[model samples]
Target: MVRAAARLPLFFLAASLVAGFLLRAPRSQRVDSEAARQSPRARTAVAATGELVKSLRIGGTIGTLRSAAIRAPELRGSHVVGWAVLTLVRLADAGSSVEAGDVVAEFELKRLEDHIADLQSYVTQAQASLRKRRSEIRILQGAWQHEALRARAESAKAVLGLPTAEVLSAIEAEILRMAAAVARARGKRQAEVERLRALVIAADLGYFDVWIRKELLHIERHSRDYKRLRMKTPIGGMVIRETIFNRSGEYAQVKAGDRINSGALFMRIADTSQMVVRAMVNQVDARTIRVGNRAVVQLDAYPGLRFSGHVAEMAALASPRRGTRSAGRMFIRQIPVRILIEDKDKRVLPGLSASVDVIVSMGQRGVLIPREALQHETGQQAGTFVRVAEGGEYRKRHIAVQGLSDTEALIRSGLAPGEQVLLKGLPRDQRR
Candidate 1:
């Protein structure tokens, strides 16, 4: 009887444990059900009828639409034959703001200036030498004139003596006649010598004239080169130094004391006031883009920032897309499109990666919601759907999508304005 009583108490304890477990199971499930109902499975949005704008998104770089490339000025004028390796003496500070006519770069003008000064001195010396030669020739001509006049006088005197020979002896007359003939001969020889000397002097003067003129032309040419050596910006903006092959055969930014070839891409002055995104569109989608279409530009650097823009221009011809291509897809081409950003912001700079959404179509009235709100069915039911909110619960509703955009979708049927839809995707049982 004692064993039975102990066994009975043990059985009662076991029974009590079983009964509590069964009773607590239902209460735990009810609590879980209440919590699930309290928390929302997906975000909800009310559908509204409004203008739907469809946009085509494209990736590109942000750059100044009116920016000008500052290239190394071509060396021109006399004595500069072939390509001249220009030595940079001074360069404008990189990223410095500048205006039109501001001096951006200067070559090693010391050498050119010294050369010009030397030429000037040479020109001065040549002028002096030419004047000295001219004066010497004049003096020689005067001496020749004096000598000719003396010869003529001597000849005249000899002739007068011959006329007096009539009252003198025959030997004296013969002597006077011979003396006059010799004097006449000497005069004739002197005249010929003076004429030849004058011709030679004129030739010497001509040589000096030619040499001086040539030197003057050379000086003019070098002077012009001097001016060109000082590079100036044609348009005002920020100066951006370009990469160059330095003396060490490595590419580096152009700086003072670097030697650059003429006509090389030296630098650029980008107009930050007006920026544009040079984006590319696949050739197939290029037909839908048109000029004057409104666009929204967003820079990758600043995720929250957006700039209003418009389609400024489109390239008529397509070119091979830049960057790497996948295998067997080497023939893909893209059309270049330039979008002009109307909003001014300091952060808009060149070479920034940007996303441009060009609004190709707009002003269509329809019931619109985010494209994420629409769900696609599979297998047996193949159509678009949305989880519509009805009173306190949600139900799946069929919807007809008329058009789709980068962010929103236009609903044509099976959905109406003032209806709420779920944006997040939920399980079938949970959605109900």
Candidate 2:
């Protein structure tokens, strides 16, 4: 009877546990279903019509049209060895207005007197030598004529039988000797005349005249060494730079000698009335930005102010380097571009840093969306999913996109305008 009672209690306990387990299973499933229904839905919007877009922005500098450094003229003047500049008489200062034929500076002339005096002495000596040569030639000619007359008289006497054979022979010998002397003197006279003519020409032209002119212009165009200086503005505007000795006793030091060769840059003048911002672009990008394209320039020095400009020119060839980040490297595929400022003020200076925006294209209509929305599937086949509301549940539809920019892309055939797309977050089941 004890065994039977124990078995009865055990059976009753097993039945109660089975009933409790079955009851809790249904409740758990119901709770899970309700939580899923309460899950937050992602909001979306349709790709809409917009204007055409461009990319590839860069910064550059605004520089003058030209700039030069003024220097001394190279004309041959009295080179005062070991004589430093005593003073600088500056006729023009930096930024000063100048006209053609204006004197810029003057040098001290005391050192040149000696050279001039030496040239004068050379002229006098040449003249005196020429006069002495002429007198000697005249004396030799007279002696030759007398000897010829005596020879002729003696030959006649021989023919008339009034002179001996020896006398005739003596006269003939004297005539031959005198003839040789006359020829020699005539030759010397011709040589002296040629020499005097050359000297006269030299004196008329002036000593070192051609050389001085060439050297002077060369120095004006190229070198920065001179004692006296004059600068006539080649182009009328402003003297962008002037290196004049300011102190009354100070002198600008130059190279020891006065000769300067070609291609030397002495002084530079520029027209500052207009300014242009020059920027370099990859050769590929440069092709897209043609001359006459409109651009917007922003100066880093002036915040919130934008300047308008247009593409003035493009480089015909690439720079000597390649790649964008290589500073000063030869660009194998990059070209320089110039942008002309529409309105320039005094604030614009050469080498001012500025940024540019080139408009490659524009439009008022295209289906576009943020670039992040696209998802790659396989090979060239890429797509994105659009959320469709069906029976209070979200369903994903795959769509195609095209025409990508840095920030946005065009939805070529994926979804139509006005259809909503999920942008904030993806559904749990649709997460990548």
Clashes of each: 0, 18
Model 1, stretches more than 4 Å misplaced? Answer: 1-48, 76-83, 150-193, 320-334, 387-397, 413-432
Number of the top-ranking candidate, with lDDT as the measure: 1
Relative to the true structure, candidate 2 has a C-alpha RMSD (angstroms) of 18.1
Model 1 residue 235 CA deviation (Å) reads 1.1
List model 2 lDDT by residue over 182-253, tens digit each. Answer: 555655565575577557645644544544455445434323333233345555445554223333444443
Q: Candidate 1 versus the native: TM-score? A: 0.72
**Tens digits of per-residue lDDT for model 1 on 1-432?**
999987998999999999999999999999999987887556788899988898899999988878778776676542354336778889899888999999899887777778779888998999999999989988888888898899999988987787698898998888889999999898889889888987898899999899989989988988888898888888899888998889988888988999877778888998788888998899989988999999999999999799999999999888887774785566888889899999988888888999998998885789999888989888888889998888766788998989888889999998999998989866456634
Cα displacement (Å) at residue 306, model 1: 2.5
* Candidate 1 positional error at 19, Å: 36
**TM-score for predicted model 2 compared with the true structure:** 0.46
Clash pairs for candidate 1: none
Q: Rate the local accuracy (lDDT) of all candidates.
A: 0.86, 0.60
lDDT of 2: 0.60
Query: Worst lDDT window (10 residues) for model 2?
Result: 254-263
